[model samples]
Target: MDIYQICPEFKKGQITLRQTETQDAEELLNCYSDEAAVPLFNSDNCHGDDFYYTTLERMKQAIDFWDFSYKNRYFVRWTIIINDTEEIIGTIEMFHRIAEDEFNHFGILRIDLQSRFEKQEIINDILEIVNENLYQAFEVNSILTKAIPLAGERIQSLLNNGYSPMNKRFMGYDDYYRRNRVDN
Candidate 1:
């Protein structure tokens, strides 16, 4: 399947994943500004302490970049909404990671959620959808996500969904996790 052909929205139980829009900048900025939610984000793209957007205007700029990236096929991202409250709770980003060297033909998944919504079940549910369909969408042989040491709940969810800590020597990055299609 062409990556762009993937649906703009997906529903799984209490959560709904929809294409993010410019209007979501406010809520999304709130999530990013949350003291508890900020640290859990992947530092690769987030750039650790350097990645901060303290205002709606800046967040809108970031959202614009996300939209531009999507248009260029750099990656696909969605705003996560809680069905019951109809609240925007988080965001999910996935991109094809195909390189000529190592880590070829893989999908890199990044999920950022509000601290309150960071539950094992919720994380599992979100990832299950990606695991089920991302291979086809990105034509990847495996999916990988980082679960930092402090992210115990996310680590557990990943384990429950068949992900294992990638070898330190092979990964060269400590504590990174992976779920290969063959493992499923």
Candidate 2:
């Protein structure tokens, strides 16, 4: 499917995944500014550094970059909202892995959340949505994500959502989880 035509808004129960906007800078700042929460964010795909925005200005800059990337067909990103509070709590960014090597034909998912919302249930719910639809969303047969070994909560959530741990011998520091359509 054409990337531009694939934008979608997803909602299941209390969580809503929608296109992020410039106005979200402040809330996103709040989510990423938490000193404790910053370290838990996974940034393996973010050009080697964690895309943690500690201030509103930085968050806005990141949002601009996200917009530029979207316009350039680089990736798609969405802000996660808690319906009850109507507040942005996290973000999910994903792109089709179009490399010529081992990662060919895979969708890369990057999820960053405020420490408070990093519960197994919540992670499973959000990841479940991505796992079920990402194949078609990115037109790939499988999806991959990275969760460090020290992130026990995240590892459990990935396991609960049909993702199997990739071999450590091949993955080293990138504790990877993979879900393929054929697995069903």
Report clashes for each candidate as comma-separated counts: 0, 0
Candidate 2 segments exceeding 4 Å error: 1-3, 169-173, 182-184
Put down candidate 1 lDDT per residue, 108-135, tens digits, no spaces.
Answer: 8888888888899789889888878777
Q: List the residue pairs that clash in candidate 1.
A: none
| Alpha-carbon TM-score of each model against the true structure | 0.90, 0.90
lDDT of 1 at 149: 85
Say which candidate scores most in lDDT.
1
Residue 62 in model 2: lDDT: 89
In TM-score terms, candidate 1 sits at 0.90
Q: What digit string (tens of lDDT, one per residue) describes model 2 on residues 60-123? A: 9889999888998888889999888988998988888777767687888888888888888778
- Each model's lDDT: 0.81, 0.80
